[model samples]
Target: MPLSEHEQRMLEQMERALYAEDPKFATALEGSGLRVHTRRRVYQAVAGFLVGIALLMTGMVAKQILVGVVGFLVMLGCAVLAVTGWRKAGKPGEAQAQPSAGSGSRRQGRRKRSVMNRIEDRWQRRRDEQQ
Candidate 1:
């Protein structure tokens, strides 16, 4: 379920306070972890692709058909991996919203709920401590 208006306002207030207190840390937190992981995957895939090209060249020089076929397969696999990672990385500054009610699987919904519960618990604890 979406946050109520009051909760949204509270969250925004917390975010602004966090930013004001520690801009660097808040900036770091703004980046999605998934984006970082996908970027790393894309980089690795590109490196693998280069290795495949080298293997293909070596096979050509040695006149080994099997080696050349393997290299071609490697390149194809790496290309597919890179493309998928790029797609998943998404646009910079895009908000990573919660999955829609009808979109995600049951397992994902459970996981999201668990995470949110943890966050709520932490928030409650902080509020209690402050009081």
Candidate 2:
């Protein structure tokens, strides 16, 4: 769904505020170049997983429990890295931008609200009172 006019205006205002507060960060975020980094991470993870498998097989043949355990741990870490990289890479730009843009929005309906959410709430309440 598209943002309503009011929401769009609010978003614009928030963006301006962000830029004003930290121009350096705002500029740094432009043209993030994340895709290449993500791809590299994925490749590294795959390589690590393959190496771990080889180590695991060698340990099993040698009957070295410590080596096998280390190999298992390495495999687990590599699997986690690959999964996270894939997940992040698959997300659209909007989904990634939303959280950073509106750090105020409740996350997955969690009970603990972010500081920005509280600030926005206060601002809203003040606006309502003035009206």
Candidate 3:
């Protein structure tokens, strides 16, 4: 159902009250609307999951059992992850990995690459160059 103007105004007033009471909570809630990093990923995952279902259904009807089964499994995995996210309580918006504070926008994926992997990549590049 669509909310009326009065209802939206009331919600806005409530949101202001919430912001005044707890800025953190308000920030979190507001972050939810335009949280490009997290929400977009979740929305993409959900869309991919639904598309997988459609593919599975098409495969099943077309007698392509393997494709159907693969699609179904992929869909099931996404569903399980969506239902149980990283948190058991199913808070999907929260990042599974938090970035370090005050690191600017680079905080999201700042894991240190392993020294071994870096060495291996260097060796591989050298081999490719020689080849």
Candidate 4:
């Protein structure tokens, strides 16, 4: 579907507003960069667990549950990192700049599977198999 001319104009206006409100934020998002949440290897998770252990020990000695809780969070984060890596987590392809809902020429191409789509399919398949 193509965006109509009016839609394109509206989209541009919104973009202008965004730039006006936060030029730096808009600019910062303009380039290709490795997303900070990219996945890590299982070993990285192990490293996090180790750090958690040290923190836990300190927390135990100091009688500060907060310290231990933070360590636990680190450990959990590590696990999440490991899982994402194992699953080959990916970022979405560039959001196609369209001219609003009715404006502009519609670009056609293959869209990458979003992370949620991948996860959903996997879970759906697992569920079906168990039935």
Give all candidates' CA lDDT scores.
0.85, 0.75, 0.64, 0.66
lDDT of 4 by residue, 45-127 (tens): 77887898889888989999999899888878877777766445344564534323344333322222234346656776787
TM-scores, each model vs. reference: 0.51, 0.53, 0.37, 0.35
Q: TM-score: which is higher, 2 or 3? A: 2
Could you give the C-alpha RMSD of every candidate to the true structure, in order shown? 7.4, 8.2, 16.7, 14.4
Report the number of backbone clashes for model 1.
Answer: 0
Candidate 1 lDDT at 98 equals 48
24-47: candidate 1 lDDT, tens digit per residue: 999889868889899999999999
Q: Using TM-score, give the best candidate's number.
A: 2
Q: Which ten residues in a row are the worst by lDDT in model 1?
A: 95-104
Q: How would you encode candidate 3's per-residue C-alpha lDDT over 44-122 as one tens digit per residue?
A: 5677689889989989899999989888887887776565442332344563332243355554423333343466567
Better of 1 and 3 by TM-score: 1
Worst 10 residues of 3 by lDDT: 107-116
lDDT of 1 at 11: 93
Q: Which consecutive 10 residues in model 2 have the weakest lDDT in total?
A: 93-102
- Write out the backbone clash pairs for model 3: none
After superposing candidate 4, which stretches have Cα over 4 Å from the reference? 1-40, 89-131
